[model samples]
Target: MKESILLVEDDSSIAIVITAALEAEGLHVDRCDSIAGRDCLLASKPYGLMLTDVMLTDGDGIETLPPVRAAFPRMQVIILSAQNTLDTAVRASDTGAFEYFPKPFDLEELVRTVRQALGALDGSDLPDAAEDLGQGLPLVGRSAAMQAVYRMITRVLRNDLTVLILGESGTGKELVAEAIHQLGNRRDGPFVAVNTAAIPHELIESELFGHEKGAFTGAVARQIGKFEQAARGTLFLDEIGDMPLEAQTRLLRALQSGRIRRVGGTEEIALNCRIIAATNRDLVPMIAAGTFREDLYYRLAVVPIELPPLRERADDVEALSRHFLARAAAEGLPRRQLSAAGAALLARQPWRGNVRELRNFIFRLALLARDDVVDDATIEPLLASDNAAQRAGEPEAGIGNAAPADFATALDAFLIQARPEPGTLYDSALAAFERPLFLHALAQTGGNQLRAAQLLGINRNTLRKRLVDLGIAPEDALGGR
Candidate 1:
């Protein structure tokens, strides 16, 4: 007998494509577009699997999971949705969903998931929904990449296991750390973040473990370190790759014993914080090079979570850009909307700087463009200019053999493609560029204002003044490197 599957999706085009694919796989597929229809289908016949989208004509598909499982305990449920957010994904997981697929998903993957779900159709304890996950999520995106990250975060929410977040700079590694801490068992406790790269090598030990008064030349007063401050909470060791070897040894000892000795104190202190470490650098190579301790790497990476760069999740660009634009408007920047053409343009960029780069670019667009609707015209000019800047540093090889200089032509095509709605482009382009330029320099210099100033070829005082003028936090100016 063929196993029957129920698919509840509102979009007809998606329904047709999915139905055709499932039919081709030799499984019986029953299509419905609403919760009501799904109910009728369920009551009439047995189904091995139910693949449903969150949004339906009448009601949410996920809301039916509890009831469906109660009635048909053996039936497996899988949620498919365009609403790709952590909340939606978590909720789907909470509903004992066999799997969750964010749309514009691959049909082949969907078929594969369906086969797996059908194969596992049996009575099991359906998990209850997680209530009140949190108020704010620093990370946003519904891409498969982000969904993978969310699942890992949920698994560690109740446990105190150490988490190592690995990603390129500007990929929101700290945001993942924050989410883990905020959504974890230690939500009530203090959350302390220490940028090991920003600290001098000599002070690394003193920073992680407090020092006794008069313990060292700078220890005129007794100081409590990050481990103590984050007791029963979370200790986020940002840029863990930059920690000195000596500090790594002490850190490993503390992780093993769950205890730390103050810099010069004879007494030992028991640490009770969940440790979350993040680094943009690849630690495996560092360990192989003996720059980073192998044992410490294993200790910190009990559960490793790698964040996807923006280029890898191009489907999420439009949503993320809108989110940032909304945030900018809420923070008193002029309100704006991104035209479809503009969003498509953004989705096409390499975004080497990743989310941080896209965010800053959006802010610049919001501030500089005179139009309420930012379309290709407004975006193309800026992108072209940026591409030119990035290309300027490249070594010139040959004239005819070189890549064609089509930046302006591309911009012109983009302009012709869409007419942006007029708004206000009154903000100075120089001012728009100045803050990010200085901030990038600061990040490259590891938040040392003097060094960043030197790199930018500006006076230290001038850099400080610019930082203040731009309302950029010293910590944030580092791009959370």
Candidate 2:
């Protein structure tokens, strides 16, 4: 297995040089230009070593060092900075930095330091081996929708075919990618991922295929690309829809011929990597509109998998809520549980942002809730107020100057006239308002209909009647939404 290294430097030139040197030495490198990019990388896989600069556009690289070290205690880190000073070096060391190099240091020395760091560390030092990769850390709920995703992942892992995962943002697309990588035969190999939308358009071609010295204006040295680094492993391309037409042609060629040629280089390099591409956008539409290549679409869709949004899996809300709460507790936050009402509210809410959004909200609640138990009262306002604002002018469930008789009547009216072709509007609206309001209210009332009604300024009997009228069963309501 190739040792994996995360190169977190903002300078494109330096990143290219370091990546090439490391690859030349047979080490796998994942490059990140900012802290946010680093965070996204860390979420999907573990790295053997981390090389970070002191200053980054998004935040200080030092701030990233401590958490990374804590999470992967055995993983070594080296600080490379143009702003290197005694105080900076001391701070980096204090955060368990393996070594410090001043800016403009020798690439050979950097490579040697990396080798020593890797030799000094053991595999057991990485994060818990990413237990059950595709399934991810226990994310609750046995809803058929979630179960289907689990089953699909299981099937995908049994083969090496390309996969295209379709889902909205925050729907755990990368998690699905990770699961595929960890469960497959190449689990031991490095999993290198690239976000097509994140890199600048002009530089993206070189970023993926690499560039020889003088390939472009600032291409001062030879650079190895992601495809070569991910050899014998998985290469996850997130937001594949954002790849440019020119790059797409090259990528398709690589997929078809199993070879890649670096920019400004004459030699063609053979590729031995698996491809897993993901996108929230509809590729078929893009292809129809002449934005995405139809041939590439067919190639990526060999084993396509679509993820159901959270609102569609309302049955899993309670389970997911508890799972996130436990995760928070494990992270040393105040321990908290979802009250019956809170859980019900969670279940009913339209989670437009999906599971990831739910997790963030739970973390926030865990921090703010006064007691160990989070009730409907506490969760309701947060979901309803913010989500209600989002729903105000939307076609479904909007409260315009013309108010309907009651909440249900208004919903029915909105559902009737504003309904688009059956599935689209219902799915979109369910994701938009009704669900969020229900979840928010249930959370506020601690899962008690009477309390939730009182909180909503309605009679308890009315609340009960409305809950039934909305086809919300007691079990489903009490579960999380």
Candidate 3:
């Protein structure tokens, strides 16, 4: 049972750093960008701690505190601000703030405070810190890569930190942003998502900063941008890598000053919204190539999270396949189970499109398979199409000198030439191949089963069985005599 935290902050950079640190400590965090968002989160679920900022887009945090305390007496509240005045601290404390910290505060101290707060709540309630990423949304997999990400999300939720999610397209970058928002202090706030790449270059600024009535030819009425709509909540900037250089500068200014001037409006409105930016492109390379701003990259990547591609976490395929199939069935599609050969086939393929593609494939497979079980016959054709696409994209080195670019293609060719029929030779050969692979992996990790399991993306128990099936005794796996 992870302790839940609520974080209310407007700075993207700060939110990222703080969230990363707190999550690393194994606490569950939720974020709210404004007072309204905070209120909504409070109304939905009870949190162990409430960390809020002094100023917000809609209203001040001090004004929001009393209502929150009145509603939930057990909830601990803390105020974070750039204002370091003695008056502000004393007033906030008097108004029921557990503590007040100035900007650039030590994140370690914040974690300590959170632990103490949780400890004070109930002696028996402190959960085992080592439990793998506790249950939450569609984000599954207990792989070390995912565990690290989960930890980062936990810490940042305890404080207002900006988050930069770096991953390839279809790897669920937006899902990560939603998780941060849903699990953080502002779970009740609106999760407004904006794709910077999708917006026209000319209208990017107006779309972000809102537009006044009659501001442009098509402006029949005043229109609020994502920033305002996400006030007291989260603003997810998807495809942020494609934001123009000019827009980046304006964004930097807004992040720094916490102010936004609407298009054709002189009034500079203060903003308090948590910012989560996701991009498939590598900002570092872009910065080096002079396309992306280096400063903005640093600003957004305070708590950078890199999501691994599906191929990299192949161990998760069977689990994810079953999960997707269940979801499809729930949605009125036929329920399907993967045959042993089908699961093996899925494991061999390189899912270039990552989780999203895998999910779509599962749904399609479920719909197509006449029987309850989806076997290799149903999987091979689809896998071949993906393999063909990959080979077409890759440059051929030579005739026989270069290997097949796609693993599925190579596997298909090997199985056909070897002529291993389904139940006997084919199954035996695969099990033989998989066993040694698992044993060798364990050996490489020096018998650290947990690490080996994570590296292989399978549970430890599964790895243990592979060692036994391969007849590689535990001593051999441990590199013993």
**Every candidate's CA RMSD:** 15.2, 21.7, 20.9
TM per prediction = 0.69, 0.54, 0.56
Clashes of each: 4, 27, 30
Looking at model 2, residue 416 earns an lDDT score of: 49
Best candidate according to TM-score: 1
Residue-level lDDT of model 3, residues 89-133, one tens digit each, is: 434544555556766577888889777877775322212121222
Ranked candidates (TM-score, high to low) = 1, 3, 2
The predicted structure with the larger lDDT, 2 or 3, is: 2
**lDDT of the structure predicted as candidate 1:** 0.82
Best candidate, lDDT? 1
Clashes of 2: 27
For 1-481, candidate 1 gives per-residue lDDT tens digits of 3289998988999999999999999988999898989999988989888889998889877776777877777788888988878777767766767777877788888899888887874524336453546446868887788878876876676678899999988999999999888777798999999999999999989989989998999799989999999998999999998888999999999999989999999999998899999988767655644558999999999999999999999988999999999988988899999999999999999998899999999988889989999999999999988889878876433211223223323323333344233432124434554666776777776899889888778899988888898899977876644
lDDT of each: 0.82, 0.77, 0.75
Q: What ranking emerges by lDDT with the best candidate at the front?
A: 1, 2, 3
**What is the lDDT for 148 in model 2?**
51
Model 1: residue 90 alpha-carbon error in angstroms: 2.0
Model 2 lowest lDDT segment of ten: 123-132
